[model samples]
Target: MELITTVIALGGVARCTSLYAAGFSKYRIALAVAAGELVRVRRVWVATPDADPFLVAAARDGVVLTCVTQARRLGLWVLSDPVPHVAAKPHAGGIRVTKAHVHWAAPLLPRHPNALVDPMENVLALVAACVPFEQALAVWESALRRHTVERGALERLPLGGRARRLLTLANPFADSGLESFVLPRLRWLDLPIVPQAWIAGHRVDFLIGQRLVLQIDGGHHVGAQREADIAHDAELMLLGYHVIRVGYRDVVENWPRVQDLIQRAVAQGLHLAR
Candidate 1:
């Protein structure tokens, strides 16, 4: 029971070396394994029955979960990926991963031998390198908003040019990934696109220029939330704000249409205060 508690404290999985160093003898561990109190992963790892399957897979496959896989696991905003993303040493051989995107670039931080998940900093670096610019920026800004990684610490790292550019643009104020996606695409308009801007006692997604307001509806915008947002739009319109509302699909699937709408609004001077 004590051994099981120890393993659970170590995140329901632990290396034999860690177990040994924690004062559990190999003989006792073997006895526990025999009695089904612990399950062996590959050779040197042990896990509780309820251990995270991803970590167990990482341990068995000799890889660290990284990139979008790790980003999702860390509760950062990331586009859906059907396959797991894992990282292995550039020269490390005999790795077997099925239908997974395996990142072979050198780690931003040295991975511990017993680590199943990549460090947060390393995960961000891998994300910057692995995903597209907008997607990667969303992840980075999500991390910033969640306080998972600090901007200053990231800025001081030996980041590549692409990553450095992303670091410069990443802000901690996006209420959703959609805002992150919209800002960079429309920055070319050279208008003031303020995110999470308060208007008439409510925060809007993006307040473009002086009067054009863009409200992006996430998955949570349903039923009562939808009604409230609509009411807010009515209120903004009453106050002389031109409101344009969109959803996940509007931003992700049909961005050009959305952009055209914004551009036309700008061309008509709708964004100008009357």
Candidate 2:
């Protein structure tokens, strides 16, 4: 009945394992002593004299272990030179440790004796940590050509959030200027429907509910097409549809108001439909 939670770094950028040594009565005091030593050392080999059985079990189970005692025992390489290892201090619940380098040994290690070495996880993790998600995914996608990782496979890993966000931002519909801001909010809204007949008939930016269409009027929507836009709106109105035009200014400078407008329009459309 042990409950475990993976500790994410302060900004939700990385995951760490928090060790809890309180419950195992058989090894309570030993566990407490080991925890203390782990906090001080920042990295430890599992075989270290101060290593606790509970902590060792947790690491074996793939729980995010961060203390030095666990790090050293896991075969993480320590630099011989004097560059300091970056350390995150223990807070309210558990001590946080930034791993200097990930060991490809345990689960990520290749199983077949004659198999070529698989550096995918290590490379992906390093790329995920260093670069923005999109660049990392690009690297991953390219690497997939020679390897077996699929588009959806990476989402099951610990770094899935990074991959998911990157892919979502790359959507053609995502606004280049507002891509980062809008993608997170888009998850809260129901996806706009794509009209079956209108896909080729006319390009609508977004169809909210069933009757209201939101058109993002970019710079391209101006000039000779201005009259055409007016004609199009008239035609949509004749077809019992409400067209709401959002200019680039509204989307870029006053997005909250734009969201409010869309929310209200959807509510009105729902009421009319009912």
Candidate 3:
């Protein structure tokens, strides 16, 4: 009983009784009866009259009991019982597919909090964790796109030049940088016209060939600039140059008409040049 108290304190409620009865007292009926009775008092809810008298007596005295029946009902215990045990049969399915788990490093976590996990991260982590890196890149790319916008995750991905270019042109608006969206596609055709090309050597927005000078009029080009522009167009005509002027709205909204005008001016210039 003194040894049992020590075991109970060290081994918690579950292991104490088993250790005492099995190691110290052996399988003797008298010891089992005495221990069992003490165990019932500690766990009255688990005590039963059909149990051994000695065990019953131990229960009445309040010794902690570890019952398999109670544990099974609560799903809290997992100890093997000496009684006969039957194993559950496995389910017969048509086919079973299994996939391996992938782990990623902390730094490689998606930069875009909204972005999904991708194959680039998977392949990187796998390689770091000792997996091969050859054909695994393609496999990872496929898996990554399914989970995330792989092209959008290029800043953090180990992508090459061509892949980066493809990603860049995919959604040009995704990046707000000047290089991506604001920069003009054609240099000489996109600049605005200035007053210097008018009288005191005002510079216009664009000069197309030697004979055609184009002006894109915006709100700022009204009032004084508009008067100057009318005067300048006459002088430019006298100088043997065709001045084709258009508004910002025409350039932005009616681009096709503006392009046609420029093309006609270019053809006229080519003919005059010859």
- Top model number, lDDT: 1
Query: lDDT by residue for model 2 over 1-274, one digit each (tens)?
Result: 2211111111111112222332323243245336652222223212233345434333333333222222223332211212112212113135332434323223332322211122345344444444444344444443443343444655566554664565444333332323323434544766555422262257665555567776667677677788787788888777777787877678657889888886787666641333
Residue 214, candidate 2: how far off, in angstroms? Answer: 0.7
Cα lDDT tens digits for candidate 1, 1-274: 4899999988888999998998989999999899999999878999988899998898889998998999999899997768999999998999989989999998878999888899889999988988889999999999999999898998888998888998999989999888889998998999898999999999998899999999888899999999999999999999999999988998999999999999999999999999
Model 3 score (lDDT): 0.39
- After aligning candidate 2 to the native by TM-score, how far in Å is the CA of 106 from where it should be? 21
Instruction: Indicate the TM-score of model 3.
Output: 0.30
Query: What's every prediction's RMSD, in angstroms?
Result: 1.1, 18.0, 25.8
lDDT per prediction?
0.91, 0.43, 0.39
- Model 1: C-alpha RMSD to truth? 1.1
RMSD of 3: 25.8
Full candidate order by lDDT, most accurate first: 1, 2, 3
**TM-score of each predicted structure versus truth:** 0.97, 0.38, 0.30
Candidate 3, after superposition: displacement of residue 236 in Å? 1.3
- List model 3 lDDT by residue over 176-237, tens digit each: 11111112323345433222233326665555555567666766778998999888888877
Give candidate 2 regions above 4 Å deviation: 1-160, 168-200, 270-274
